[model samples]
Target: MSEQLMVVGEITAPHGVKGWVRVRPETDLDQLAGIKRCRLFWPDNKERLFEVEQVRPHRQIWLLKLKDVSSRDEAEALRGALWMIRRDEAPPLPEGHYYVPDLVGLEVVTVQGESVGEVSEVLFGPANDVFVVRRSGLPDTLIPAVREVVKEIALNQGKIIIDPLPGLLD
Candidate 1:
């Protein structure tokens, strides 16, 4: 199998009889624009690398066309397959901004240097991304993505330091 890459989107369904497909992008629209090619993988581990032929925003979803796919049957066959691009292929973001997948598995600590937990997930809510910390022998805690609470995020070192407000972790 090819090395697993970051999933940028998924083939939700065939859009038309001429082979257009509706893609539900997991990445931001700006980030998606930077992906000129993608590696698609099916559930059975089958994979194909395709150059992006066209991409356009359609309502909330993205309409995509692959260089080789030319029929509704071809597109339908790819439904549910994850469309991934190399992590390095993603466009660079400004400082302090991070992709959700990049934040997972980082060690979380308090400003006092006490180990709080490890980041298990990054949840997208109406407000902002919530960092889900899984602590040992305790319930998971949700840390809001705010500058006041999150003092530092060291992605290179796989660490995060937070100064959680009182009762925030209770």
Candidate 2:
């Protein structure tokens, strides 16, 4: 565990004239009200903890009002900010599922003992996620997150063992 922050939502846009921002949360909508605080990551690489003042459903999205953000311009300034929460604050995930930050940076290798590279990023899809393996000189490898392909993920060992499909790595 590399002290990874869980991305919970994103500030999409300013809502109305209040300091409320529309957020598209990654967590369950029913559990949104329980979130009272979070860490905000700015595009400039700055991060800060914010106490949630209020949060409510607004159609398909949720409206959020953070403490100290009291103007429409203030909320607008936070547009596109990634709302994150501490790993401990996030709900527990089921077995075999891992957070994005935990998977990133892990060494990737084939089950036959061939070294691929490290997981630099993960692309989420509707059906499955793809692991982006960054090789030394080769182009990044796209490893599909399927049981037949991904043999084992040993987070404790800091590596992911994959059984590449035929021509999948070529």
Pairs in steric clash, model 1: none
lDDT of 2 by residue, 72-163 (tens): 99989899899998877765666887777788899999998889999998875668779999999899989998999999999999999999
Candidate 1: list runs displaced more than 4 Å: 1-4, 56-61
Once model 2 is optimally superposed onto the true structure by TM-score, how far is the C-alpha of residue 32 displaced, in angstroms? 7.8
Q: What would the TM-scores of all predictions be?
A: 0.84, 0.72
| TM value for model 2 | 0.72
lDDT tens digits by residue: candidate 1, 1-170: 56547877789999988788998877556656666898998899999999988888887788999988999999998899998888878778878777767888999999999998999987656566688999999999999988889999998889999998999889
What shift in Å separates residue 22 of candidate 1 from its native position after superposition? 2.8
